[model samples]
Target: MRITDLLKQDTAILDLQAQGKEAVIDELIAKLNEGGRLADSQAFREAIMLRESHSTTGLGDGVAIPRCS
Candidate 1:
């Protein structure tokens, strides 16, 4: 599947209220959970946080792509 395929109206946030990276991740996880995308939100959050602990996910210019499998 493509990124566009995964990013749907239900999962997309137009005006994000999250402040920092951690908050953003939490918000996104919640969004995915509400959209019925994530099977286990806590597990997914833990995996993402583990990946983040190894290194930064911030790309640059106030952008980040946090991911885990």
Candidate 2:
């Protein structure tokens, strides 16, 4: 599915205060719960974490693309 399709309204944090990977992950999880997309959220987060463990998804321009498996 498209990234936008998986992103729920609550998942869009226009102004996030947390800084760091862990905080970001927590925020994402919270958003997923708020959006009522637990299944999709868990799958997506897991994929991101796995990929991050192998290599950074950071594209070097301050952008990261986390996808769902």
Candidate 3:
């Protein structure tokens, strides 16, 4: 599917209320879980946290692309 397809209203956060990195991850993970996109939220959270520990996904200009596997 295309990126637009994945960025539907169910999974998109128009006005993020999170204030920090971890908080942002948590919020997004919650959204994903709510959309039935994650089998285990805890596991996904751990993986994402581990990935962030290595280096930030921020690409500057207020953009970030966080991913985990």
Q: Each model's TM-score? A: 0.86, 0.69, 0.85
Off by over 4 Å in 2: 40-46
lDDT of each: 0.88, 0.70, 0.85
| Candidates in descending lDDT order | 1, 3, 2
For residues 1-69, what per-residue lDDT tens digits would candidate 2 score against the true structure?
Answer: 667765666678888777798677768677767887676666667777887788776777656765434
Q: List model 3 lDDT by residue over 1-69, tens digit each.
A: 355645778999989899789899899889989998878999989998999999998999878877764
**Against the true structure, what is every candidate's RMSD?**
1.6, 2.5, 2.1
TM-score of 2: 0.69
Model 2 residue 37 CA deviation (Å) reads 1.4
TM-score of 1: 0.86
Model 1's lDDT to the true fold?
0.88
Q: For residues 1-69, what per-residue lDDT tens digits would candidate 1 score against the true structure?
A: 356755899998888899988999999999989999888999999999999999988999978878874
lDDT of 3 at 53: 91
